[model samples]
Target: MFCYQCEQTDRSDNLLLGCHSVKGNCGKDDRTATLQDVLIVICEAIGQYAVLLREKGVVDPTWAHRASYWVFTTLTNVNFNATVFQRMIADAIVLRDELKARYEAACTEAGETPVVPEGAAQFVPDPGMAGLLKQAPLVRVDANIDVLGADVVGVRNLNLYGLKGLCAYAHHAHALGHRTDETDAGIEKALAFLGDPPTDLDSLLGHALELGSLNLKVMEMLDAANTGVYGTPVPTQVRVTPVEGKAILVSGHDLGDLAAILEATKDTGITVWTHGEMLPAHGYPGLNKYEHLAGNYGSAWQNQHAEFAAFPGPIVMTSNCLIEPQPSYRSRIFTMGPVGWPGVRHLEHKDLGLLVKAAQALPGFATTDPERSITVGFGHDSVLANADAIVEAVKAGDISRFLVIGGCDGAKPGRNYYTEIAEKSGDDTILLTMGCNKFRINGHDYGTVAGLPRLLDIGQCNDSFTAVKIALALADAFDCGVNDLPLSMFVSWFEQKAAAVLLTLLALDIKNIRLGPTLPAFLTPAVVDVLVDKFALKPLGDPTEDLANAMAGA
Candidate 1:
């Protein structure tokens, strides 16, 4: 029951260096936690066959998407029901076994022997809860720590967690009807590497970097998937306040599901509001065209307990960042995709009519709240549209620098650093933000620069691609390397998705990035030393001091 895959992981400097208690920070019990590791073991096995079958060009992309989805369910704040995981275990085994059979046949046709993975890689879960619990110890995340030192374990887990986050993005892109063989094979290749479990730190760390490169392709597909459906994001101001009517709050980063919900509720009198990462949906022309798509309702995922409870209508979690649903609203709140809680109702295949019913039954927004708004939809295309102005502003020194200071936000201590950095930036600097980290200081006025808003909201965490594209365009416009541009990155990571983003930055050879509030609990001082030495990565210090140093080109 040990885990440290998210920012809110226990860091008491204990033996496990993670949540070894009955309940984790996201309210995941030990039973569910161990079962998640077991599921991952199955994924590694699937990947082992998937990689080979892919080479033979016989693997099904649906299975790869399934494997990626299984990884997404294991992410922090996603699924918490042990019973649901039990069924998933059985289904994953069927999937894994199907791949195993194909791999054997392919080898037979090629007249070559297929080497099968052993131990957890090919583990068969024993029947009943007792048998499952008994098998859990063999596949725990730290199972290799005793044989291979902590350093090797740390690097291996880094690669594993990076794959988890990268797969989540892949799942998102696939949901939007986007899939690529190259990325699918890469995901399987990563799983196959983890199946063998490397004992060397260098091999593990190097693979982590390769994962970063792979994530770029996944992000590009996701960017295409979104723009292809939504007709490219335009700068649109979204109301941050509530309006009068029956309401339904849709959270997470699934635009496809959100569109379905909108279609289902077109005339039901339920006004839909985007929450958490879904706030960026307003900027999309396709979504904005819906007359009942009201506005944003809450801040970030961490505040869901209070916000969801106080809300007037039923809530729908489209994908992730779900916490324990309170008794107050548990009955009305519904889980979609991989999100599940023991008692919370689950929506199947974006069948949002259930939410339409729940919202109509409840009182929604007693009256329209005061008007307030925030700007979003600064996708690469939107930003690049004003490329001429931005390049000229940079050359004229009107816009001194760009700061990317956002990632997944958490409920842990020290996150105020983001708020401080944003507020402390000089008028000459432009603030670019993504993920829930923007909720920390986005509501504050930072004023405009270079004939545009100083703080540009770049949609969700996946939109980190947009930020990178903007930087690259700037570099090309100025005829310099991306690293040579007057830019600085400060990443605030809470979960594995953020890990994938950080790895992408590192793969690009981008250096001098700062990370905090604390290093990942899974990483040892040895792993940190390697990052510090190679990438000039540093732990964040005083925000004001760091901002000043960044401005001075330090």
Candidate 2:
């Protein structure tokens, strides 16, 4: 098996390229990796037909939405159950076949000859698990790397990973009754191009950037979905310390599941605590109204092994970044949506009867912990509403710059760069960020800039639109372009959602982005050179040096 789709892909001395051993850094076994590869091949095939069917208006968005959610399942740290992947593979083939038939029928009914897609789109998976596993090596991500060269394959990974990011965010939007035809069609179009990939380097790069531009729209849709369902988030104080009660800790990036769990357990003597990306839910008016939706716990996804094991009650993961569950907490931990682990119980249709029972059966907090609080809910609308004061502060020298440091966080070493950068950003600079990356610097107090909180936690990675919108509003208030603002973006990436966010930033023509813990393993030297030269992107450097350069306009 071969995989290098995330920031934590094996990069040790021997295997320097990607994970090729019995297991990946994310703890997915070889069998699950191979099955995901097989399913990825299916998503490409579905894209080939879904793109055309969308154009013809032959079928509704059933297949397009299905393909989007299906690809999401293959993202890093999402699903680790090989048996679940086997079932998804079986179901995907039948879905792809039905989509193909519908596309053909639409062409025939219109009296036009249909052109069948070739390569992965036309091929069918072998029967059963063993046969499919046998086919896995043939369709692995790097199958054509030797022929197409690393540059071409690198760009292809860009497109494919970008597709994964878009689909993952789109799934979040769809969950909140938000859907846009353009976003759905763009996902299919990118998938179709990847099905029979082009060898032209420029075409591949352009397609990848298009996926980036499209991802911005998906992020916006997600922002709208969250705000439309829950009220727009406002500045609010959230208790980080434990509240007294039988508690349930809900982690990951799904607010819908969090809201459902809150409603299900309302006044039942159980206090629901948010974790990881779910920490920002405390700021939403709709969710905060529940007296029992108490406080956030722990840090980012990578720290879950320790935090989950210590939590006194059952923990629920509503989205990505589920690691191998420890034996101690395996039974009490539950998986929801596309997140899955082999022995962990899964939550379906927001049903938490079993989870509720588990929560009651386990001992919760014995008493109230110390009152520790952190202020969240500084979303785009919230920041923009304070635009006048922020602009005034910048002009009066109260705020020197806006250092936007954010994106996904992982278990790697160099991630401390984000921490140091934010800490040294100084009180004169406003620290803007989102996702678990904030965990690096949020623990320290940078104080306020112009009466506005220094570190702005917009929300989860899904709330990326808020950061961009805040930047644009700041630029507008300053009467300058976004690139001209005194802003420096340092993005820490761990998975595809971060990939999507980077693409959106690049597509908006944002420049001087400092990306790290390391460049993606999938990017060859040539592709890296091309990105650096084209977008003026820079690899992460020493925080002191980078900060000086950012201040000196280097």
Candidate 3:
């Protein structure tokens, strides 16, 4: 199979042969490869439209949303259906031709080679036919370097993956009636860079960081869109035990779907419980006010197989990570947005009749357990509102340090480090978390500091924007730079969004972050050195040792 969705490949060529000898690696077959090809074509087409819109000073919400969704769907492990992808490609090409014609006419009137959309697709010349176009090229610069061995590929993977997250967030914002010209332009520019010819390892590394920078802007736009529409998150205590009798458990990261579910279920005698990243929805002013909005059920995505199996009612996944649904819970598992698993019901539109019917048919959720409550919210707004109290706590030595330990939670057992670190952290320390990864420490009884819960679940992964906001606010309140604040980021990364957030932190000049469980396969020594020297980035070590270093450094 031919593949080149990332920057790193063998023989200075963008394409690579599938390692047929190795099973489960890449999990790609010929069909998947073709689908990826189609996806690249669609991205190019979308890029072309995006560039046109940018130049025309007119933004099309539908085009922007569709484009972003296309990019996100191409992310690794997201969508593998060749038929669906090909249809999307067909749609994209149709749109591309229409936009190209419009652009060409406008340009002819003004006199110039119409600016080929920022991320426009290029036809590759076939080696066999001299100049004849063979097929469309993948959306990655041909960084044919062996400089850092597999590290180059790793960096490439990181960049592409981060773009996927950026696209996903941008798509979500578009859905919410929020639009930013700068974000739209950034997507076009970044996609164009990804599809450019390969440069040096250092240059690619810079692009990786740039992806993070752009993601920050995208995430900020999403943060504003979410908070503006839903109100700033406040500290909330959500119950873990299902409310006895009929209920629905909603997972994944789509707030819009969650809101819609709440609305549809209103006065239906069905209690709504949250799972995974959806747990933090409990903090939102509008969501929290739901009388039937019970509490969170599971911790993170990885534990869903068992947790979901044990769940008492129908479960809906708005956008799950690595969806490996067990047959036991498969019928109860409903997918929405881009998330899908064969045989699982997918609710893509606002219609929740199926969910309602399923909830009504099922035995319904169990009663809320008084002993099982998980506190949520603690987002940027809540944290900043309590900035004075936090400052006072710090001044009084009640809080000596703050650690941000949150990112993608994977099934790998090594992730236990996060829980261990949280459990062992000093009583005077504050743990700020986001994403499903917070489940690692969510169950820990770290108590509180100055009426503030020690562990703060700041919402979904995109809420990393809130983490940055809190850091900046704290720094400002303390009359010092962010690096000077008693704050440490020990992030766990498993996908592109994590890469983007890491880059944002580096861009902000936040130093000495400990990243792990394993460093990205990307990041050549030279590139890593630049990060180390410039930002003091370090790989995570033993929890005990890292904690000591963190406290000592603070």
Candidate 4:
């Protein structure tokens, strides 16, 4: 396996660029890794054709969206099925050939010869695993690292990984019937950029920053999609304990699927509980209206192995971050919409009848648990609506500083740092949290300051933009730059989505961000130095010491 897309990629004292073992640290084997690389290379070629078609005034949004989907499926720990990737590769080649014919015909009509790149544009994919494995080394991430050098490889990966995250966000938003021509065009351009990547370090670095800017736009569009389709999130309390009934636990980030399930099972006496990143769905008024839409059931995505096993009823993964199923719950686990496993039932036509039937058949929790709940739904609109009060609290010294302490969470050993940082924060500090990392400290009582919950849960990882808006509002109210505000960010990264968020933060010039549990293995030492020099990005040390340093600086 040669995968280094996530922060948890195997990195020993000697090696850093990739995990070249038989199995990656994330449990992906050599076949899946090789297939993922082949899929990406094929997608890049498709993007090349799409770019030519766009240049010829033919606007087909399908190619751009499919390119994004192909990239998104290859994200760290998302898809592990070699069959799915094989199908995608086959589909991509078909698209590539069609686009190539179109581009050549257009060029010929214009009395010009079409210039086609050689790698993926001309190469044909093997139909079988043996042939695919033979071609794997030709397209693996480190295939050209020796020639392009570490710094250039690092920047190229930074852009690629960030684009992967951007597409994931855009995919979810698009599923909810919210996507724009502007966003589609940007995705095509970024994918084409990948087809013909910049070799020089400076150009690659510039492209990485441009990717950051593009990610910001995609994130903003996602925010609009989530809030515009569903009502803007408000402060709603979500129950942590289950109600006594047949239950369906929904995991992952797709509200569209969740909505369909809720509507399908409405008034059926079966309860729908959210797990993992779906915890924030309770905040949306459109979703919250379902009385059977019960509370959250699990912690972060990494804990699903245990949590899903213990849960008594059907469990549905609506999107990414699905792990290999345990035998205990594998029979009951179902995947929907882009996420898949070898044997798991994949839901199509937006139906959850099988899941509902499973819930009805299984004996759910016999009795209700203790009445425990947490406050969620403090998104940008909710926070900004209370802007005057927050400004006053800061001025009166009631709220000392704001701490943005959340991002993607993983099963790494040192992730407890986020929990400790949230726990040990001073009474005067307000910790604004979004994403799955909030699961670390969210179960604990942080108490309130100035009538506001110190630990604010601002929707999913995509809602990082809401946190950005809160920062901008504070900076604007304070009449200073965003970095100048009495706010500090401590981000815990596990995947490329967090990488995209980090890039957006850097693009906005938000400094002094402390990122952990570790930096991406794809980033070389020189690239790390460049980030430290330019954006003041800090790798996490001791949690108490880091919190002390942040408070002291504030």
TM-score of 1: 0.98
TM-score of every prediction relative to native = 0.98, 0.98, 0.88, 0.97
**What tens-digit string does per-residue lDDT give for candidate 3 at 300-366?**
7767778888887899877636355778878877888776544566686666988998889888754
lDDT of model number 4: 0.86
RMSD of 3: 4.4
Tens digit of per-residue lDDT, candidate 1, span 370-389: 89999988888888999999
lDDT of each: 0.88, 0.87, 0.72, 0.86
Task: Report model 4's TM-score to 2 decimal places.
Answer: 0.97
Q: Write the residue-wise lDDT of candidate 2 on 183-268 in tens digits.
A: 87888788888889888899988888888899989998898899999999998899988776699999999888888999888868
Comparing 2 and 4 on TM-score, the stronger one: 2
Model 4, 1-554: lDDT tens digits are 67788866776745555678888877788998888888777777877777788789877878767877888888876777878988888888888888889999999998988887755676677888998889887777776877888778778888888888989988888887777878888887777787778688878878778778888888998888888888989899899997898999999999989989999999899999999899999999999999999899989998899999999999988888888899999999998877877888888655677878899999998999998998899998888888999999999999998999899989888988988898899998999999999888888888889888888999799899999889988999999999778899999898888888888898898889999888888788899999999988999999999999998762
Top of the candidates by lDDT: 1
Error of 4 at 509 (Å): 1.2
lDDT order of candidates, best first?
Answer: 1, 2, 4, 3
The candidate 4 region of ten consecutive residues with least summed lDDT is 8-17
